[model samples]
Target: MNKLLFIALCAASGTTCAQTPATNPMPDGSRDMYVGLGVQSAPRWDGTGSRKVSALPVLQVQWSNGLFISGMSAGMHLSTDPVIEYGPLLAVQPGRDASGTGRSADGVGTYGPSLIGPVPEPLAKFDARPTRLDGMDKIGTRLTGGVFANYYVTPQWRLTSSLLYGAGNDHDGARLDLGVQRLAVDLGGQHHVSLSAGVAVANRNYNQTYFGVTAAEAARSRFTRYDAGGGLQDAHVGVRWNWAWSPSWMLTSNVQAKRLLGSADKSPLAERSTNLTVSTAIAYRF
Candidate 1:
C-alpha cells in the first residue's frame, strides 16, 4: 500500500516538475509539491505476466536545489543544461508479491497449478520456505542505486536512460532502461499530452532470480526446469493526457501496452506475451 505514494514518481519520464516558490517559509528555496488520487494498473510482479489495477495515491516533490523524490526513486540533479540533466539515484525495488500461487488474482498463474493439474508442491529446496500452490518465490522490496541521464532533443522531445544495480539480496542483479518521449505543455495553458516508448534489459541473475525454474522445482511443480538468461526483457509504449480542469486541479489518464521479450517470454510462468494497463488521476497542484 505504501507504494502508492511513489508510483508515478518512479514512472517519471523526466516529466516537468514545478519548482517550489522562493517565498516559502523554509530557508531553502521554494519546493514544489503535488498530491493526487489515482488508479495504477501494473504487473503483479516483475515476471508474472499478470496485471492489477487498483486505487492509489501519487506524490511529487522537487526541491529548489535540483533534488527530487518520486515514486521509487530519489536523486540529486547534477546538471540541468538546456539539453542534458544527469544525476545519481536511489530507489526501492517492488519485489514479488507475497501472494503466491492460486486461481485468484494473487496467483502466479491465473489458476495456479490447477490449470495444468501439475505436481504443484515443494517450491524450491534452497528457497527454505514452505511452498505455495503457485510455486512462486517471495522477493523482498530492495534498494537499487544508479545514475540517470535525460537528453532533450527539443523542448518537447527527450531521451532518457538509466542503469540500476541491486544493493542486496532483494535483487542481486542489475537492469537498464532507455526511453524516448514526446510531450507538449501549455496547450492554451490547459492541456498536456505525452507519449513514451521504452525497452528494458536485464542480466542473467536478474532474470533467473524471478523467471527461472530449478529441477527441484520442476519435479514438484510439474514445470520444466527453465534457465532464463536475460537480454531484452520487455518493450512498451504509452500515451497520456492531462487537462487543467481548474487553477487548483488537473485530470490525467494514460494507457500503456507492453510485450515480453527474449527468454522472459519463454518461461512457463508467462501465460501471455503482451499486456495492457490504464490509469487516471486528479491532483491538486500547489
Candidate 2:
C-alpha cells in the first residue's frame, strides 16, 4: 500500500516537471469547484507494523475574490494501544485480615512480610481487577470542512488560511491551516503550473468511555474506566502541483507528511503516530 501511494505521488511530481508557466488569463477573477476521489493509508508511527488503507473523497470550491470552502471525508480500519501503566503492588487491609498484618487497600502490600490470615476482601468488587489502560482496533470515518480566505501578496504570490472542523463516527476534531501558493508565470501568457505548501494543527476527541468500560455482566471482568482527554492532534507539511491541461481544465496533485504530536494518545481512535499521505485530483474552471 505504501508503495502504491508513493507511486501516485511520484506521478504527480513528475507531471509538474513538464509545466512551463504562462500568463494568467482569469488571474484575479475566477471561481471554480473541484471534486475528486483517492486512496489513503495510516501507517504505524513507531515503524513496527503494516499500513492500513482507506477511500478518500474530497470537494473544494474557490473564487478569485479570496473566499473558498472545502470538504474531505475518509474511512479507515486501524488499531493502536494507548495504555498508561501504573504500579504492581497488591492491596490488603490490617485488622480485617485477622492476623494483624500491616497492609492497605492502597496497594502497599510489600511494606512488610506476608502473615497467615484471611485476606481482606476488596471494598469494590472490581478493585481486584487491573487498572491503568489502553485502546485498540478502531474502525471509522473522518469528515472535515472549512472556509478559507486568500490574499494576493503579489501578482504571482498568494497567502491563504482557513478554520476547519472535523467530525467522525468514532472521532471528532478541529483544525487550522495556514499556507502560501505561488503561480509561476512565464512570458508565453499561459498559466501552466503552481506550487503550494502549508502547515496544519488539529485537536481531536475520542469516545473512550464507549470502548473503555463495560456495564454488562459478561464484560465485567475485562473492563476498567480510564479518562481520555483530547489534545494537539497532528502537524503536517504538504505541497501541491497544478498542471494546466487546457484553457479551463487542470490536474492537481498533493503530498503531505503528518506527525502525531503532544497528547495524541488520549484519543483512542487516533493512530498516535506519524505518517505520509499523497493524493490527486482533476478540476475544471468556468
Candidate 3:
C-alpha cells in the first residue's frame, strides 16, 4: 500500500511540472536599431496656392524587452503665389468715374454736365483709389520627436504611450497619446506581414504663434489669439506594411488620418487649415 501511494504522488508532481509556462523569446534575432530617410508632402488647401513638402529623417532604437524610442525631423515649406493677398485691405476704388462729363447750356441733359452757381456744391464724391492688402510669403520649419515604450502582456499584444512636440508655422503644439497595439495572426509563416491598430487623444495650443502673428503685432492689430483650451484632438488608426527585401533591410509604409474634432481657429484663413499626411520609408535594421 505504501508503494502505491508513492507512485500516485510521483504522477501528480510530473503533471504539475509539465504545466509550467514557457519563457517568451526576444524580438527578432539581433539588436534592433534602425535608421531611415524619406520625403512627405501634402496638398495645400489653406488658400496658400502652393503645395507643401517635408523632408524627413527618422531614427529608431528598440530593445529586446519591447521598449523603443523614435524621432523624426522635418523641414517644411509652403509655396508662394503672386496674386494671393494675406493681409488687411489698404485702399479701394469706386465702380464709376464721375469727372468725365462735359458742360452745356441746358441746366440738365443726358450724358451732359450742368452749369454750376458761384458757390457750387458737388453732386457726389468719387473715390478712384486702388486697394491693397498684406501677404504671407515667409518660409517655416517644423521639428518633432517622441519617445514611446511598449509592454507585452502577451506575445501578440502591447500597451504604448508617447509624447510629441511640433514647432513651426502654424503647428506649434504638444501631444500625448496612450493606446494599445496588437499583432494579428496570419496563416502564412513567421515572415508574414504584421498588422497593428490603436487610438489616441491629443491636446493643442492655438496661440498667435500658430497664426504667424507676433505678440506685439497681435496687440497692435487687436487680434485675439485662439486658445484651444486642451480640447479633445482626434482618434487615429493605422496599418504598417513591413517588407523584408533582404536580411538586414526592410521597407515600411504608414498612413494615418487625424481630423480636428474641436475648433482651431480665430481667423477666416485659419479656419480653413486642416492637415493630412502620408509617408513611406525604407530602413536598415542593425
Best by lDDT: 1
lDDT of 1 by residue, 26-131 (tens): 2368776666777766555433444455775555566767776553456777774646768787666654534531111110000000011121232243243222
Off by over 4 Å in 2: 1-31, 34-59, 63-160, 165-173, 178-231, 265-272, 284-286
Give one digit per residue, the lDDT tens place, for model 3 in 1-286.
Answer: 1100000000000000000001123455433455776654432322111234555444544343333333321111111221111111110101111111011010000000001113222112211111110232232333344433334566554454444455334454554444444443333422323333333333444222233344444454333333434444433344434455666665654433333334332332232223333445666766
Off by over 4 Å in 1: 1-28, 46-50, 98-133, 167-170, 185-188
**How far is 47's C-alpha from truth in model 3 (Å)?**
12
lDDT of 2 at 32: 50
What candidate 3 gets wrong by more than 4 Å, as runs, is 1-30, 43-51, 63-68, 73-154, 163-174, 184-225, 265-275
RMSD of each: 9.7, 21.5, 27.6
lDDT of 2 by residue, 44-91 (tens): 221112343445443444444333333321111111111111111111
lDDT of each: 0.53, 0.32, 0.30
lDDT measured at residue 141 in model 3 versus the true structure, 0 to 100: 36
Candidate no. 3 TM-score: 0.47
**Residue 185's C-alpha lDDT in candidate 3?**
33
TM-score for candidate 2: 0.44
Per-prediction TM-score, please? 0.75, 0.44, 0.47
